[model samples]
Target: MERIPILRMGKFLLITIQVDMHDTTALALQDDLMAKIARSGARGVLIDISALDVVDSYIGRMIADISMMSKLLHARTVLVGMRPAVAITLVELGLSLRGVKTALDVEKGMELLAAALEDGDAADQD
Candidate 1:
């Protein structure tokens, strides 16, 4: 069984999807990511899909599910590197991916996560 690599960077988990998404792989990723977030105490998740040129509805839903699950686990999710057609497909499928933050690239995504984490810390101190 092939698994997607999830890298832990400081308080963030970075995942770069570089292969075609399958049902089993997507499920595994979701479970693995949730466990990592819990065990690593990660504050944020950055998913880079720059290599993926197409995104079906299933993939879209999986992305949304991952984001929602991470949120429930107390981690913010930022999806980056989305292609134009992939974005259109997501909208066409009505998977609005509500509550999921997005960025044009990995750098911006990291920045977004950092700012959000900082804000969260400030709120915690309040």
Candidate 2:
């Protein structure tokens, strides 16, 4: 079983998907990520998909599920570095990723996640 590494960056988890993952690999990633979030008490998840050229419906749904699951576990999920072609493909397939946030790249993704975490922290303080 191939496993993706989950790196901890302060209160965030950084995941870079560099391969065109198989379904099983995707499933494993979902599981591993959830475990990492719980174990690390991460406040956010940043997934970099810049290297991927394909965004099939299955992959799109997996991303959505990962985001929702992360939210349920008290973490924000942000997808970053999506290519234009892949974005168009996802749109044409009608997967809006309704609840998932996105960024243009890793740096912006970190900024976005930081802002979101700040907002969350502020709300919790209230």
In order, the Cα lDDT scores of the candidates are: 0.93, 0.93
Residue-pair clashes, model 2: 0
For all candidates, what are the clash counts?
A: 0, 0
Name the regions of candidate 1 deviating beyond 4 angstroms. none
Candidate 2 clashing pairs, residues 3+ apart or interchain: none
Whole-structure CA lDDT of model 2 = 0.93
| Tens digits of per-residue lDDT for model 2, 17-71 | 9888999999999999999999999999999999999989888999999999999
Model 1 C-alpha lDDT per residue in residues 26-58, reported as the tens digit of each score: 889999999999999999999999999988878
TM-score of each: 0.96, 0.97
All-Cα superposition RMSD per candidate: 0.9, 0.7
- Report lDDT (Cα) of residue 97, candidate 1: 76
Error of 1 at 32 (Å): 0.5
